[model samples]
Target: MQMRVSDEDRERTAQQLQHAFSEGRLNQLELEDRLEIALTAKTYGDLLGLVTDLPAEHAPPVPEVVELDSKNGNIKRSGDWSVPRRMRVTSKYGSVELDLSEAVIAHSVVEIELALDYGSAKIILPEGASVNVDAFRSDWGRTATSEVPGRPRPGHLSVVVSGKTKYGGLTVRYPRKRWFTH
Candidate 1:
């Protein structure tokens, strides 16, 4: 009997392909070819072939991790970087900023652990992505966010900001695009 695939399965395959591309395992041409196959795959077996040779998501050697200390001054991470499963942000007298607009997220939800002391940190995300900063707080400073997103649809990526800070501030912004009428 022939099996069938759901829309969620297709999108999940596409996301996996994108993650492989970001990890430099797949070149643009290879990624495009695999994406085409994954999106149009009819059954689970077909989709499995596309990522069979790729690394298993569950057993990735180590989560991508970036760190900033007091000496690094203002820190910024942007462009086609892969969003690790877990990220640690430690700012002691320095500011840190991370932009996830063009990033390739490995998992459905990314976790960020923050530890700031007398410094500031900001996380900027593209529209459509969901972020939960509910577990964040500052002692002397404050936390500001544009707007918390409602429950995200399936296949939507999310980020969870947790941890605590003292004498530091945390800000989260989601920039929505506006189309102007001619």
Candidate 2:
């Protein structure tokens, strides 16, 4: 019996091909060819063949969950950090700031579970990235995501921000543009 692949499967394969190209494992022509096939592949086997030859290291293992816990201090993450598939953040009386503009994100969807009390969270996403806060709940707090859309964009990262906040607010926005560059 043959199994059919979903659009997500095809997109994942294409991302893998792009990663391989960035790592120098595949040349421009090879990347283009594999991407074309990956986008059109209708079966798992067809997609698997595109990345089977690449080194295993090229595909980093995604952790099940990464926890960022803070008690009295701020939790700040920025500058080329490797983003996990799922994250749980627990903070009390401290602010949480995650700047993912230059982060390495491999997964299509990133889940962020926030448990904040008397603190705020600010998530800075990269260009083309979208965020969803449908599952997020706050008590006496506010959420400001007016600068970004709530739906995910094709071929881009989608962040799902969930969990509860008390006496604190949540802010999701893109990085600020630098006016001058040297």
Q: What are the models' TM-scores?
A: 0.59, 0.66
| Clashing pairs for predicted structure model 1, backbone only | none
Best by TM-score: 2
**Per-model CA lDDT versus the true structure:** 0.74, 0.83
Model 1 C-alpha lDDT per residue in residues 1-182, reported as the tens digit of each score: 02467787788889988998999998999999988988898876687678768987812222345444454477678876566788877767688788887876767888888888777778887767788788888887877454647455577778888887788777777755779999
Leading candidate by lDDT: 2
Lowest lDDT 10-residue stretch of candidate 2: 55-64
lDDT of 2: 0.83
